[model samples]
Structure formats: structure tokens, C-alpha cells
Target chain A: MSSPKVEIIESYCKGCSICVEFCPTDVFEMDGFLAKVVRPEACTKCMQCELRCPDFAVKVH
Target chain B: MAFDYEQYLRPGKLPHIWCPGCGHGIVMKGLIRAMDTCGLEKNNTAIVSGIGCASRLPGYVDFNTLHTAHGRAAAFATGIKMAKPEMDVLVVGGDGDGVAIGGNHFIHACRRNIDMTYVLLNNYIYGMTGGQFSPCTPVGAKASTTPYGNPDPTFDIAKLAIGAGATFVARTTAFHATQIDKLIAAGLRHKGMAIIEVLDDCPTAYGRRNKFRSVIDMMKRLKEIAVPIKAAAHMTPEQLEGKVLTGILHQEERPEYCEQYQQVIASAQGD
Candidate 1:
């Protein structure tokens, strides 16, 4: 299977770090006040980021 | 293909008021997915919520929505369900709203076995009101009001619902993201009163004072503590202490209130 793709919508990201904190695979990193998917290879397609983001900022596929 | 969240959300409601890392969003996503999986019509579904952090959910959903008075979501939902009968009415609220001030309505609605779905978001604190301890707050947990530590015993909302005669009751946490959706869908499918108490995390309000290192830490703790009902059956009481059992806790078929009320109306009109 192909690796999962993770997208972080910068405008919706409030630097809450929920995606970084909740991602079981550590698929995200903080880039200033916004979350950046620095380790997309580790994305497990769990959609934890997409579901848990309060700002509706992340989407995983 | 991806789920088109915009298709189910109200425009200009983006950037919800929930603080960063709060679990209310996760529960909201689970509810929306449940609605999608059930193929519920937006025009036929009514979302009602009371005033609180979790109650803000109805405002974002694209449905017949009501942001009701504090602790009165269920009452409003009951009215909507009775008037429309065929409409799918869902109530969303936090622990404080559902169990504290609204506790009476919650139990009576279950007792009446009304055809409606209630999703109680139990985040342990009153998140929007600055972290006060709620009825579902774990005993001895520190809250803004209980800076020293809480003295009151906490409530088990699922058990309460079951005792109050709800036809369907279940519990799940935000960590079990997919399970949350499945349970919600099941609850919606049930014909009588259905209550799904979701253990959502309020990292800003509940976690910070409780000493969870981060949002992830709280989520991990939720996973660690949730024992599936089937698995819990084999465990000793000692092993099960302080652990929450996840899954359908109880369910039964009963004559729903709205259907029964319709019969009464028909009889009265005939007479």
C-alpha cells in the first residue's frame, strides 16, 4: 500500500500541538505557531490529526 | 476520496471557539461521521445543544440546529422530536450541562424513552467557564474551584442513563476515534432513547491543572484506561479499578415515547 498523505492547513492551525502530541507515529512538528508535517512517512492514516484538531486544520489521507 | 466536511458545516463557523488541543472537536467529528454513515438528511436532522464548550457543536453543523439555554438541550430536543416525530433530533452537551444543571431532564428523557440521541461530552471540567469541577470530574482531581482537590464523588453517566431506563447506552473516548463514530451510529439507529457518553479531553482546562504533560499524554491515558466490555468481563475487580469499560453497556427494545404519544393524539382526535 502507498504511504498516507497528511496535510496541515496553515490558516486553521493555531499551534495547539494536538496533532504533534496525539499522532502515535510522531508525524508532525511545530513550525513556529503552526504545525508542519515534517515526518509524513510516519503517517499511519489514523486520521487522529484530522479528527482531533480543534481548528479543523489537518487532513490525512 | 475524502469526506467533504464543508458539505455538513456552516460557513463562517470555521475556527471554532474551542481552545487548542481540546477533545470536543474529535467528538464533533465522530458525530458528523455517524450522521454520514447513517445517511441522515440534513434538513430532517435537528441538532440541539446547551451553553458550554461542548455545546457549541450545534452551531457548526449544517442542520436544524438550536443553541439552547444552559442545561436545557435535552428538553428542547424533546420538544423538537415530539413536534416533528420523524425528524432525527440529537443533543450535545458537556458533563456540567448534561449532569449537573440538566440532570433532571437527562434522566426523565431516558425514563420516557423518547426517540432521540444524546451525546454527552464528559471532559471532567467546565471548559468554557474556566475549569470548574463538574459532576463527572474524577474525585480528588484538581480544578479551579478545587484548587486543593475535589471533595465530591463523581457520577458514572452511562450507569445513570441505564438506570433511568434509556433503551441504549454506551461509552467511548476520543482516542477510540472510529469506535466513537460506530457507537454513535448504532445509537442513532436504535428507536428509543439513546445516550452515548463520550469521555473527551479538555487539555487547556482539565489537563493543565491535572498535570497531564501534554494533549497527547491525556489521550494516551484515555487509551490506557478504556477496557472493552468483553475484555473487562475476564478481569478481576482489582484489575478493573479506575478503568472505564467501553462499548454498548446496555440496550433493549421499548415502546418509544413519541410513537406512543402519536397514538394518544390519534385517539383523542377520533374521540
Candidate 2:
């Protein structure tokens, strides 16, 4: 399997910082008011950012 | 392949009306995943809700949905289940709509042991109506209606369901996102009434008044207070103080209401 790819749908992100705060591996960072996938390589594919995100803005593939 | 949430979401319903960091959306996602896990057909499933922020959930899902009058989700779902016994019925609503205004209906439905899954999102305050202190709000928590402090005792929703005779009762927080789907899936598979109370967060309504600085703080609080049922058993009463137990709290087998009603009809017809 290849490394996981993390994406953030900017339109749906409400900038709650939930993904940034809860990611076990520091996979996301806040860019102004939105979440950005700053370190996709560190993603363990736990899906925490995708599942806990209230806005459904994060996706891991 | 990554799970496709769009397959269950209604078209053009994206950007839901919930507030920023609202936990309702997460609960909706869990419901969708549970339906998928149970292989529920959209045409054969019916989702119903009453008037509240959490009540708006049925509107976004692709299943047969009903947005009913305030505090009447259970009543409406009961009618639907009776009329179409084969259809899978699900009810979604908030603490106020489920335990306060709809308390009578809620308990009666449990007493009937009707075959339906009720996902009650307890956000403590009435978020849609501007942060009124609801029946589930903590006694000392502040809300718009309780400027000084909330004086009302909180309702333990899972206990109420179990006491009223629901066949299955479970409690989980929105922070436990993965467990939500598992519990809801279990409820869907159960043969009689199932109540799943999700401890949700309302950053805008409940948090601001309660001195939670941000949505993250509220989410962290949920994480802090929740202790899984298995872990709680090993802890002392003092250690478990102010902590809420999560996981399936109750389960039992009971004759479903619809099947009993059918027997009554057969007897009346002299069959």
C-alpha cells in the first residue's frame, strides 16, 4: 500500500481547529481560519481528523 | 476505497445549518455510517425528527425523512412504524425535544417496546432556541434562561429508557466518533426499542455561557468526562465522580408492540 494522502475541503471547513487539536500525529495545521494538511506523511490512517471533523472537511486516502 | 459519505447525503444539502464545531454533524455522519453498516435500504428506511437543532438531521439524509411538529418525533415515528411494519424507523432529536417537551411520548414509546432506533443528541442547552437551559443541562451550568445558574436537575436519558422498558439502551459522547456508529449499528440490529443517547456539544449556545473558551475546550471536556463502561468498573466511586459512563448500558428481549397488535387483530377477526 502507498502512503496515505490527506486532503481538506476548504469550502466545508469551518476552521474549528478540531482536526488540528485532536490529530494524534499532528497531521493538520490551521491556516488563518481553515484547516490545512501540513504533514500528510505522518498520517497513520486512523481517520480521526475525518471522523471527528464536524464540518466533514478532512479526507484521508 | 475511502468511505463515500456523499452516497448517503442528499444532493444540494451540503453546508448544513449547524454552527461551527457543532457536534450534530458528527452524529449525522455516525448515523449514515451505521445505516451503511446495517445495509439499510434508503427506500425502506424512514428517519424522523422534531423541532430543534438536532431535529434537522433527517433533512440532510437520503432516506425517507419526516420533519414533524415540536416534540412529536416519537409519535410520528410510531405511526410510521405501525403503518409500515417492514420499514426501518429511526428517530433523531435533542435533549429538550426528547426528555422535556417530548418526555411523555418518549417514555411511552419505550414502554411499548416498539421496533425503532432513537438517537437522542443531548447538548445540555436548547441551542436552536438561543441557549435556554434544558432538562439535561447541568444544575450549575449557565444558560440564557439561567443567568445566575441552572437550578434544574439533569435527566439520565439512558436510565430513563431502560426504566421505561426499552430493549436496548446505550450512551456515548460525540468525541467517541467511532463508537457512535458501532452502538447505532447495534441498535439497528436489535429487535425492539433502542435508545442511543449521544452527549453532544453546542459551542455557540452552551459553551459561551458556561465559560468554555472555544469549541476545542468543549470537545476536550467531553473527552475528559467520558469513561467507558469496562474501565469504570475498576475505578472507585470517588475516582468516577463527575464522570459519565459510556457503552451499551442496557439490553433485554421483549415482545415487540407491532407483533402484539397483529395478534390482537387476528383474535378480533376470529382467526
The candidate scoring highest on TM-score is 2
Give the alpha carbon lDDT tens digit for every residue of B1-271 in model 1. 3467888999988888887778788888889999999999999999999999989998999998999999999999999998899899999999999999899999999999999999999999898988999988898999999999899999999999999999999999988888999999999999999999999888888899999988878888999999999999999999999999999999999999988998998999995
What TM-score, to 2 decimals, does candidate 1 have? 0.95
Q: How accurate is candidate 2 locally (lDDT)?
A: 0.94
- Interface RMSD for candidate 1 relative to the native interface: 2.0
For model 2, residues B99-212, the per-residue Cα lDDT tens digits are: 999999999999999999999999998999989999999999999999999888889999899999999999999999999999999999999999999999999999998889
> Deviation in angstroms for A24 in model 1?
5.2
Q: What i-RMS does every model get? A: 2.0, 1.2
- Please tell me how candidate 1 rates in CAPRI terms: medium
Q: Write the per-residue lDDT of candidate 2 for residues A1-61, one digit (tens) a residue.
A: 8999998988888998999999999988889998888888898998888898887778888
